[model samples]
Target: MAKELSVEDAEKKARELLDRRIASVRTLVTARQRLAELREQVADADREDVRLYNAALNDGWSPDELRKLGLSEPEKKARTRRRAAAKKTAADAPGVDHQEPAPVPAPEPS
Candidate 1:
């Protein structure tokens, strides 16, 4: 047997239930927004990872085919030329010593 409630009690119970439902909906909405923010952050990190990987590929070392003995002649010649130029520059500069001489200490008096 169901107990009959007065009009005022029924209205109050309905208002409380409605308030709880509204709060639950608000919590769900907040959780969904947070999930969306996390997804965007993950997407941004993925984009940056791809960018870094591509940059590394573009600026990285040569392939094995390019490192063969006969195939690397031009690179060797360019490196040699650069080294010669650097040596010439160092030789031409005055008051600049390239060799490391022995360090001399002050003589201690008795």
Candidate 2:
């Protein structure tokens, strides 16, 4: 079997490696934040573009004319939403009776 690192040793080694990777790690974090900001701006821009196109169409601008003017139609991004699962109640569950049935009595000897 391969040698395993102890908890303390692992943490120590991890800390040591972090010194080499700290700059790259910081860069990754900054890139992620920048990407998020850009995505928000893109969404806002898409909404604005669609609004402008519709308003222009209402103002008698043709589709051909809009296309010739270098405007591209927005491709919408699909967002997935998660819903919370409903909790089951004891009464709603099967084979879970709240009240007990009456007991049966034995017959006497003749």
Candidate 3:
């Protein structure tokens, strides 16, 4: 014979499950934030490595030596046509202020 649960007991069981689910969601949010922080730290480390490599090169380090140290110049990024078009459109949009100053015209040669 199966026992029938009272309404109060059923409500308590439901509340417990809801509490567990809320806790799991909170844990998930915390884990996601930690992952984002870790990614940023990795990006910062990459930038530091590039800066150090540039400094070493400027100090007369040979490319071969740099390669031996597992260092290389950062690759130039090539923009796709779609991205270029979007960028140009954005730049040409009204009320958009570009950070770069307008080009100064060179003085006429004497």
* Candidate 3 wrongly placed segments (more than 4 Å): 1-5, 72-110
Model 1 Cα displacement at 99 (Å)? 98
User: lDDT tens string, model 3, 1-110?
Assistant: 89999999999999999999999999999999999999999878877877887899899998789888887676544656654444557788789986899899999999
- The residue pairs that clash in candidate 3, if any, are none
- Ranked by lDDT from best down, the candidates are 2, 3, 1
Report the poorest 10 consecutive residues by lDDT, candidate 3. 79-88
lDDT of 2 by residue, 1-110 (tens): 99988999999999989976998899999999999999999889989988888899899988788889886555666888888888989876999886778888888899
Estimate every model's Cα lDDT from 0 to 1: 0.71, 0.86, 0.86
Provide the global lDDT of candidate 1 against the true structure.
0.71
After the best TM-score superposition of candidate 1, give how far the Cα of residue 70 lies from its true spot, in angstroms: 32
Of the candidates numbered 1 and 3, which has the greater TM-score value?
A: 3
Residues 28-94 of candidate 1 have per-residue lDDT tens digits of: 9999999999999987876676565455457763544444533331222123433444445765689
Clash count for each candidate, listed in order shown: 0, 0, 0
- Candidate closest to the true structure, highest TM-score: 3
- Candidate 1 — which pairs collide? none
